[model samples]
Target: MLKLTDKQALEFGIQPVHHQMDNGELRFRLTRDTGSSYILTLSAEQSGWQSSHVHLRKREFYIVEQGWIVLALRQSEQLTFRRLGPNDSFMLPPGLPHNVYLSEGSVLHTVKYGSADADWEAAPELDEKLRHETFDGKTFFTR
Candidate 1:
């Protein structure tokens, strides 16, 4: 994994054209012409949520670059919740139902591979409220 500087993150974040989903989530597509793989950065400020969906053809990895996030994963009939901070990452394989909830002002750097387009379903019925903390390498609660 690459450790991004503030300037690099800002520059990369500004490159892709972003759009809002039917659920009102906001994501910036960072990579163009990458062919079979794409990068995206999600914003909590826009929708207060992340990807509440499942991919059947590609694998998705959520890497926390800034702030904090509480991720919910439902695989096979089991559900789990995890709180992650900067540099922490989690992978959701194909056929797994996963949802990520942003902590007010969270930012997640995500990557999807092995598929050119997304074959997924958005899960709006699994809405949740997350309670967690962020570690910014300085003050834990000052973010």
Candidate 2:
């Protein structure tokens, strides 16, 4: 799991609230004062792949703080797979269908414009292909 150094934590000037998810992942909610929020998440190797979903109105930004992760995004009839590692960042606009596969020791830092629980919508149709497809460690495009 990636963590903030003492110097880094002091620089941020914010306290984080910790939570343990049901999937055994560790999450830290860093800020929630305004309409936006920041979150830090550490994924367990055994956490497996996440289901496909989309946000109807919310937007999200993510940075890979440690280890590796695969983001599978579907746009229209085409699908794109992006393999991300430390320092890699991406943004998801509203109405984009996506899923994530976190590798062992993966850590992600996220910024959200709104509450995920309220805007999240499931996209079960993408699950079958997204979960079973092979990622080649590069950006891949498929129909």
Candidate 3:
């Protein structure tokens, strides 16, 4: 079994991130095998204007484990936002623009299946986006 201790994980530089439209937290897990896959968690304390303009080559799956989240999805200009809480599993297909906002103290388990390349676009694009910023504007710099 893969047992990742908090100390080991933090020692490995596991850092909280500040993502678009969030003022909370962001954690990450990445695995590169025959399939390009990763697991990311987002916890939000603010509303989101987040989005994914990149199309996926494979399906993306997400489950809310902590609090709640709102997903903004665009289909041919038909915009929709869905609120999701714990025990919610959303599977998004390729080529769709989607963004998720984590509610207060929210935690999400997100994973992508198969080798997929997707462009990431969180609307309100900030060229000043410094990577490793926490959802709370706390910046954690990395190489």
| Best candidate, TM-score | 2
Better of 1 and 3 by lDDT: 1
Overall lDDT per candidate, in order of appearance: 0.62, 0.77, 0.57
- Please write out the lDDT profile of model 1 over residues 33-130, one tens digit for every residue: 33233455555444344546778877878888877776677755566667788889998788777776665556677777766564768765444322
lDDT of 2 by residue, 1-143 (tens): 89877557646655567887776778888654344668888987564566689988878898999987788888895788777899999999989999887776889998878653567789998887776675444554455
* Candidate 3 lDDT tens digits, 98-121: 666555677788777655344354
Steric clashes per prediction: 0, 0, 7
Model 2, runs deviating above 4 Å? 1-18, 30-35, 114-117, 134-143
Indicate which candidate wins on lDDT.
2
- TM-score of each model, in listed order: 0.63, 0.72, 0.61
Pairs with steric clashes in candidate 1: none
Residue pairs with backbone atoms closer than 3 Å in model 3 (clashes): 17-134, 18-133, 18-134, 18-135, 23-135, 24-135, 54-119
Please list the residue runs of candidate 1 whose C-alpha ends up more than 4 Å from where it truly belongs after superposition.
Answer: 1-15, 20-26, 31-37, 40-42, 124-143
Root-mean-square deviation per candidate:
8.7, 6.1, 10.1
